[model samples]
Target: MLISDLDCNTLKTHLSGQGLRFRTGPFSVSLRATIPAIARHIAKLYPHSETLDNDAFIDFHITTHQVAGLRRWLKPQVVFSFDGYKPFKPLPLAQAAAAFEWGLNWCIASSSHQYLIIHSAVVEKDGQAVILPGSPGSGKSTLCAALIHRGWRLFSDEMALLSAADGMIHSVPRPVSLKNQSIEIIKAFTQEPVWGERIEGTTKGDIEHMCAPDSSVRQPPTAIHAKYLVFPHYQSGCLTEITPLSKGRASMNLIENAFNFNILGHQGFEMVSDLVDSLECYDFTYPDLKQALDGIEQITSAKP
Candidate 1:
């Protein structure tokens, strides 16, 4: 069934009477009025994958009609459908659809490549993938946006799916989210950046997101041994500096940022450990984007 065959009208009826369609590399997601801003946030990362198709790598089949009824009749929670499978807990109607789309992408990546998906942002220069893994306030997305504008390729901005056996970072390019000042910073930096509607009142405060270009998404996923695992913190007035971090410390930090490290158990530990061993680890701090980009270029160029 092509994307056209899926009953768009039926899907719309189940949602609260609104619809917006978005595509990412091999995935297609349709959102209703109740959809959250985050879904729109990551859609920019994969531009080439935007074409509607019957054979999507992942398809989110969302219906709001069953959420309340399922919770009341079967269980006391919301229900979401993925290729017809039901998730019992209902997500906030606004974010639920997008969340399901992301979840489906996660399921596909993990199952197919033995990748442990970590909530992170990634940018590539040359053949090396630099992963930025952090919590919401960590300024990763902003930095990623800057780098991509300055010629770095975006691998992903939300989920960094790294292969367990090979240590190559898989590309799952999605939107790059920028909050408050970062939005303005990126807007001023790029001449024609693609952005969705600005969403307000999220836990991270007022927010807006930009989608990566289709060109970035269509490029083949590169298998670069990690050259740097730099943890970034954007502090106002602080000079850009890169400090060395031990492999063991980097491993611990990575585990904390991982989405399924515990699920992978000892193998997870070893995969991450091996990854750190093959790369340089650093704690990067910057008050300016240019300086940070310069530092990153220096690090990447110095690598053999």
Candidate 2:
């Protein structure tokens, strides 16, 4: 059964009691939280996600609760815990849902070492997957949001899971995070965007999460061989440009964005090198979303 199968009262009851176990891509997550906002967030954002049995093997066991003592009554903050250990400090209760999303990202990137995880946004169209690895403020999520709206399937918004053995990209589609001005930009770009509350004054500035497209969430997860490695740069008034990169340079760029290259050591290095060799690496810079979408469409639609 899906999370949508449960009513609000039932969901809250489960959350307050044991937890809500749900399947996200390859991982089984059991999330326990009493925060009403988080309940609403999941109801809207993850309604298509499947709820797992209670006895299932959970990959990430998480809990978010109001911090104890006067803080819970005074400022009202929420702390995120994994396996009973608190990994991060408390944040305002209003940001509980955002905290859960951030906490989940940490869980996957830190523990899921089976895959060569890279800090990138991945989307696919007609069997061609594009990996967008960009630094903060490089318009990665913004461009990803645009592509998914234009009929590309979103693999993930935060990271790409490249399998070590098969060299294929795995899907981990969830809510697309939009920060600061990008929030309004995407709201204006899309016809009807289902967004969480605008969380203000966080470490990442104003933040909001746009619910994943129904197609991206409902579709069964599958591995896709990536065709393009595009590093996006959103420059104001700059003409759309796509410049090819050498394999050597592309490998280095990917390593810099990788989450556990040193942990995997030689295997990770070889994986990055081999993946770059097969991909058409490029530096993509654009001023407007429309032009960016067109530029990507042209390449992804071409003969492989």
Candidate 3:
């Protein structure tokens, strides 16, 4: 059953007690939390994600709870735990929900070595996938959020799980994270968006999350080969431009964005080599979201 099927009381009971196990793409996560905001966050963003039974094996077992001692009552803070080991310092209790999202990202990036993971946003269209690898403040997630809402299928907004065995991009579609001004920009772009509460005054400035479309969440976990490797540069008032990039440069960029490149060793090198060899690599610069979307559509639809 989906998380939305459960009432608030029941959902909170599960979260506070034996933990709430849910499926996010290929991974099974069990989250235990007493934070009230967490319930609201999951209920809204993960409404369509399926819940797992208690007996199921979870890939990441996490917990977010208020810190003990006097801090619980004075300036309350929360800590994130992975299988009983606390990896990060406590954050303000108000940021508990965001903490959960960040913590889960760490879990997948740090442990899921079976696939060559890259810090990129991926979207698919007409069976052809576009792999976007950019640094922070590069408008990566903003462009991703726009593409999925336009016509493309949302593969992922945070991580790209590239399979070593099949050389295909696996989908781990989750809520699209919007930070700072991008939050309001997207709210204006989409007609009606399903959004979590706008969290302000955090380390990443103001932050919010937009739910992935129900179709994206419900789609089967199938891997698709990538067709484009576009590194987007969002420059206000600049004319939209797409420049061809050499496969050698694209391979280097992929390695820089990769999470487990060194961990996978030679296998990761082969995967990067294969991807750059096959993908139409480019450097995409845009002034506005409309121009960005149009340029990408034109390039991806062109004959390779």
Candidate 4:
């Protein structure tokens, strides 16, 4: 059954009771939280996501609960838990949705070592996937959301799962998180991009999640070979430009941007190097969103 099939009341009951098990690409997530905001966000953002059986093996069992004592009554807060253990301090109760999203990211990055998790945004088209690896202020999420709107399949906005054996990247599509000015930028661009709710005062400033397209959310999990490596840098007034980067440099960047390079050691290096050797690397910089996308479209449309 799809998650949206159940109303808010039913969802809340399931979460508070047996928990809600759902498939999220490579991981089966079971979420439990008493917060109505969590229920509402799931109802809206995860409408197309499959609701799995409780007997299913879960990769992450997460929950959020109100703190005990007088603190619960005065300036109430919520703490996120993983496997019955709270990993983070309490956050303002109003940020429950944000906390839930952040907690899910932590669950993947911290524990899921089956794949080499890279801090990158991945999107695919025409059997070719472009891996966008960047640091803060790199406009990776912005580019990801834009490409999804333009019809590219969303792989992931935060994490790119690279297999250690075959070197293929697995899709972990989820809601694209938008922050600060990028929120308004997307709103003004798309006619009605599916969005959950606007949250303010986040560590990354105002944030909201652009819902994964129903097509992407419902797509069967598949692994695709990486065809291009894009290191995107966004500047206010610069003209869109793409520069070819050497395979050696791209491999180094992938290792540096990887979440668990040290964990995998030599195996990680070999996996990243093999993947880079097969792709054409580039440095992409842009100011105008249209021009930026056009540049990418032009690149992806070519015979690789």
lDDT tens readout by residue for model 3, 133-252: 878977999999999889888999999999888898999989999999898788889866699988888898989999988878887556898989999999999988999999999899
Candidate 1 C-alpha RMSD relative to the actual structure: 5.6
RMSD of each: 5.6, 1.2, 1.1, 1.3
Ranking by lDDT: 3, 2, 4, 1
Model 1, residue 82: what's the lDDT?
51
Each candidate structure's TM-score, on Cα atoms with residue i matched to residue i, is 0.75, 0.97, 0.97, 0.96
Per-residue error for 283 in candidate 1, Å, reads 0.9
Stretches of candidate 4 off by over 4 Å are none
Candidate 2 local lDDT, 1-304, one digit each (tens)? 9898999999999888899999987889999999899899999888889999978999998999988898888899999999987778999999998899999988998899899999999998877899999799899999998788888898999999999979999999889999999987888898766888888999999998888887887775568899999988889999889888889998999999999898899999989988998999888888988888887876676654
Q: Which TM-score value belongs to model 3?
A: 0.97
lDDT of each: 0.66, 0.89, 0.91, 0.86
For model 1, the superposed segments whose C-alpha errors exceed 4 Å read: 1-47, 50-113
Candidate 1, residues 102-179, lDDT tens digits: the string is: 455554544543777777888887777788887766788888998898888888887777787677777766667778
Candidate 1: residue 108 lDDT (0-100): 55
As a whole number from 0 to 100, the lDDT of residue 106 in candidate 1 is 50
Candidate 1's error at 265, in angstroms?
0.2
Candidate 4: tens digits of C-alpha lDDT, residues 123-215: 988678999997889899998899988878998889999987668899888899999988888888896567888888877788899888887
